[model samples]
Target: MMFDAWLTFAVIAGAVYLFVTEKLPIEVVALLVLASLLALRLVSTEEALSGFSSPATITVAAMFVLSAGLQRGGSLYRLGELLAQIRRGWLLALAMMLLTALVSGFINNTAAVAVFLPLVIAATVANRQPPSKYLIALSYAGQFGGVCTLIGTSTNLLVDSLARQSGEAGFTLFEFAPMGVIFVAVGVAYMMVARRFLLPDLGIPEQSDTGHAGRYVVELLVGEKSPAIGRRGSELLPDDAGDVVMLEIFRAKQPVSSPRGEQVQAGDRLLMRGEWRDIEQARKKLRLDYDHVARDLDGDVAAERLHAEAMVAPGSHLIGHTLAEVRFGHTYRVRVQGLHRHRLAIRQPLDRVPLAVGDVLLLDAPEKSLAAMRSDPGLLVLGERVQERTKLGRALLAIGVMTGVVTVAALGWLPIVAAAIFGCIALVMLNVLKTEDAYRAIDWRVIMLLAGVLPMGIALQNSGAAAWIAGIAVDLVGGYGPVVALLTIYLLTTILTEVMSNNASAALVVPIAIATAETLGLDSKPFLVAVAFAASTSFLTPIGYQTNTMVYTAGGYRFTDFVKVGLPLNAIFLVMAGLLIPRYFPFS
Candidate 1:
């Protein structure tokens, strides 16, 4: 290998290792890879940053904004709520599968999944079923739906860009629909079966008892001058307490579990579990305040205010801080009642647990503070809607804009990228979503990841690394004939996708697929189509695709669940793609 090829392989190997271990957020890892390439002089700064301006990146970002507008307008929620009325589990699952896939075919799958997420969660809550059963299906549906159209996923667009870059015609809108629809049909059938046997029914979430606001356990200290010093614990708080339950009382450092009628004393510690509103009321009644927070639960709970669930958003600066270090109470004006990490809930003495990207916080904050937290991109309020209901006029306008964008692109009046950008502008002008929120709606993490990884692909192609890899693949599989060579490319792309960003996978593997086809003296379009379809079929891992990651925490699923359900589905897809790609594109 040449110097450039060696450098490219080294970077790829490092990136793959980092992605697998997840020591750093994938976006950060991607940026690091980009910076390394720049430092190595493998590519110019322009090439390194070209992905930011790439149509695939812009289209994905615009789609996010557009989806945010629709979500903000309450159109998606309304549909979700309607779907929540379905009592039969199988029917509901089918509806979600079909709806998510259908919408994803037109819009970005991440946005489609996000819009539908709350609905599935709410429906699961109402049905007293575990969200785990349905969320994976939703993620899978998004992938299937995304494959149905050119704009359905950034992966497809990335492949299209690669094709054009490689001197081939780009895919027109709906060009993949025929094959994509078949794959979607197969996916839907597979998911329906998985719903019955593969998925787990987790029952009601532990926090469900606290109602839609979520539950939190907090400790409060009684001041010497507090009004409730002589009062019984039950009487000191509200009669209903809004699902708040006093779990324990510590008098003179002695533990008392379920102390309902215990009299309060100055400096006495009380452990409580309840909703944010209830916690706030109890704190006020006890004269507890944020400034008076005890050093530990044994000391006091004065500084903590309310109880609710807050998820660390992707790209949040808050990712690696412990509650005490962050001055979390003072900083966010809320106290964390519990920590839910990796689907496991940890309660009490939460001072040292470091927050991660997907860790959900059971927080206690005042109503005003909680409202403020809602707008903070660093934290996401869960199990409730803090924003106002979407206006019907604005929602209708958003729907119209989305339809217009799709129409123009489908008709070739404007490219998907331009149409999507115009639609974003329309959303803001029509008051469907605010300009600031529109920008915020775009997940910069994803944007930067795509931007950073695109250049890596350029580097690979420029360094002859892509062709070298493709030639080797062809040599290894060419003896097996063209059909097997096609299957090998499709399978390789699918595997790579599960371990990396779909766009990056498509970018890296498409060149190899093209080279392999050329080596076999066959039309490359079949191989290209196979790679495109394969790249979008990321079912084996939660981190494989954007939509899967979105649902991972929301559904409270383990990584193994994806593997369990996705493995079979992936095999089925591999077979389906191998059989169908040549029929559609023709290897001869």
Candidate 2:
């Protein structure tokens, strides 16, 4: 191998490591890949920058807006409301899966799940069932539906774009439908049987009679006689108490840099967190003075301070930063009392707890603050819009535009990019969505990720590295026949997708899949299909898919829950791909 090839491999290994550890955000990792290649002069600047202009990138941004339009205009929410009428548990689960899968085939999977999530939880609680029984199924169904169409996921379009760049006629809108439908059929049925045996009843979350459902973040003033003065912050709350944590100590009105290690002062203002009842107990036991926020809650029988549950919205800026870093209480004027992450309920020291999508926060927010939080676009305060009459005209228009977008692209009236872009324009012009809402609807992180990672594929091809790796793969498995090659590629893509970004896995593997096909003197379509399908089927863990992450906290599922349920499903997919992909698109 040439030095450049070796260098590219090194870059690839570094990228894979960073992506798996998530030591940095995905877009940051992607830009690093681009910068490494540029600094090494691996590809021309044009080729490196080409991803920003890629059809896949533009189409994906447009799809985000379109999906947001559907959600905003109430096309999805109105449909979701009907599930509330379901009388049986099995029927409710089945309907949630079917509807989410069907909707996901056209829109972004994350958006589909986000719209239906509260509804799923509500219906389950109403029926006295654990949300655990149905939430993972909802996440999986979104994946099932995503594979059914070209526009369903950015990954599908990305693979198509990569294939087109490789000099092949790319896939059409429904080219993926036959296989996707098969995945949906196998998945929905498998979850139906497996959930009963494999999923545990995590139970419904409890709410406080005070209307605050979680822990409280409050500021306490140190009294002259308080024993807490001169005590270290860590000692403020004993480990066994599990009730209160001193997040920060304001010494003489200025925050000490390290709250825990810093000793408290006589006049320090301490920011503490725990359940309301527990916090009250601590304040009394410690002889502390309560701040006005506390007194407001203490004396207000009128309930002017509203308790609402807010979820970190998908694509929210709050994903990685801790609450203290965001100055959450000060910025939003809400006191967070409780937080649920994955399957664990965090009760104290919330300043260090970073937020992620689907993390539900129990908040004691002023009525005015609740309005600001609702309109912030980064938080989904449940029950805020439950009764807003669905916009009949705008809903129909949004539905019509989305349908037209899918139909035109399917009919070859325009490329998927043109159709999606025009559809976004139509929605804004028709007032189904506001212009600013249309722009806000797009997850720019994904756009930047696509723009940055697409060039890594270019680097692989241009550096002769993809061919070098493809030769090695062909040498190891080529003699075993093309079926073996197909399975090998599928497994490799699946494993990578489980740990890293799906689109990144596709961007990296598609070039190799194409290279392997050319080396073996076979058609690459089936290989590309294997990449597309494998990349989309990320069922092995909570963090692999955004929808999975959302449901992780909402469902109260442990890591092994996904493994217990998704393991058999993954095997079924491997078998399905091995048996069916060849039949659908043969190696000639």
Candidate 3:
């Protein structure tokens, strides 16, 4: 039986690695784990499914809906707009980093990062700075800042809930505030200092050179039989595309990626980057005559556009709609170029394929259209954009309801589960969030991931595997005493988070952290705190946190970008937490 439990543990760890590495779609990985557990009889099907209803899961879902309400209300956007006007270089970066860290302390870090990315880019551009410098800082700041509060990130919430289940007093919003604030302050100071010396001034040379706008250069040809053969360049291009500024037109000569709009002729070639697919489709439909001779002309023009990516929310209006039905071009003035169904590639024509929540869509549209599409309840824009504001009264009311629910639960007036459900209902009734929006905000991938992984945690606890692991942990640092043991838990969780999803890492490590604390007969609060902070502070790799991944592609950062900035910050936090945990909650 013990061997069986260990085998279950091995299976789960391997599965989590594969899932986080994205070798398989997260939902599929989850479903497979659930099936395997049931087949092996390690846990009953009911036990495996119970995590779906767990309080932690409910709270996470409710928080997501609450984030939507806040986003819809436009409060986040307003905050972002204020940040964009700051012009001092290092001072501006510090302000943005501090604000991001503060905001992330109270909301999902991923949402926090998404909301601030555009603001950071705009601010950098306004200050005549390269966006790449600020983007990396913003991503790391959000992840680290979330450590300041229990509601700051999902990892904190998960750890708190697990502590409660272990019969310990769970953390309050402010419980972690002291350490979090200090860490963020130190981090802000570090960034302010580093920005001056370490970062390069790679901003585009001219006002016209706005690389921060995220446009790609590409080439398009006018086929001889196309409808646009005789049309003027300005007339053939849509108003949005025309505004992008064509750099040049190549005719029986070398290629041009940017052609002057007025210079185009029937046999002319366009060298452009802004919304190329829309241009190509327009050219093909119009039957113009030319060849894609821009030496830089790349494969799949649609994929080259920066604005072409989207993720399906859990309960979006788009869930059942096909691209054709939505008249993606006619309605939104955008093209659905690629679809990721359940995180796997969907090779079929997007027009004929039905959409589902969690499916990622690659779209091609002008920048303005792309911005509008992001705020649309039917689609979750994957690219970074400025946050938008909605009805404030509604947003406040929803926040008030959540506050009340948390208050009630803390007071023992209601169970956390009941309070969460009540909060969900209150948001809907107040019209702060629509029923569909609320449902879509829930990340079923996370819910399923948690559900599938919980049983394995249980198996670890049920079998002697946890004890064996704990014993090894104890021996490795036994001479160093309980403080070392606490540090070990924190370091282990931190390391795991760099390679896996923070939530998944927490689920795997919390059980071990708890068991280790028990073996030492010490207060588990410090150990739990370590796990919470470590899981939320995954900065070394983009794969560690969703916020990191969100900024990775948008910032055009390579993998080493994360390592360069994050590794040092991770070390700083690890040391700070190790020192502080012992001081705050000493072991007997």
Which predicted model would earn the best TM-score? 2
Candidate 1 vs 3: which has more lDDT: 1
Error of 2 at 197 (Å): 1.2
TM-score of 3: 0.76
Compute the lDDT for candidate 3: 0.68
Q: Candidate 1 on 169-284: residue-level lDDT in tens? A: 78888999999999989899989899779887655754434333235556677777888788787776766567777766777666655466777778877767665567777677
Q: Of the candidates numbered 1 and 2, which has the greater TM-score value?
A: 2
Q: What 10-residue stretch in candidate 3 is worst by lDDT?
A: 205-214
TM-score of each: 0.80, 0.88, 0.76
Q: Which 10 consecutive positions of candidate 2 have the poorest summed lDDT?
A: 205-214
Tally clashing residue pairs in candidate 1.
Answer: 9
- Top candidate when judged by lDDT against the true structure: 2
CA-lDDT, candidates in order: 0.77, 0.83, 0.68
Candidate 3 regions off by >4 Å? 167-169, 199-331, 336-372, 377-392, 402-417
Please provide, for model 2 over 1-588, each residue's C-alpha lDDT reduced to its tens digit, 9 standing for 90 to 100: 388888888898999999999888898999999899888888789988989999999999999999988887877878888976796999998988999999999999999998888787777776777778888999999999999999889999999999998897699999989878988998999989977888777766443233122444666778889988778887777455557766778776667888888887777777776756677778888888754443333444565777677889878878888888998887887777656555444433555677767777777777777777766667777533343357888899999999899889999999989999999999989988889898888888899899989988888888899999899999999999999999999999999999999999999999999999999999999999999999987999988888888777666577898998888888999999999998888898
- Candidate numbers, best lDDT first, in rank order: 2, 1, 3
Residue 559 Cα positional deviation in candidate 2, in Å, after optimal superposition = 2.0
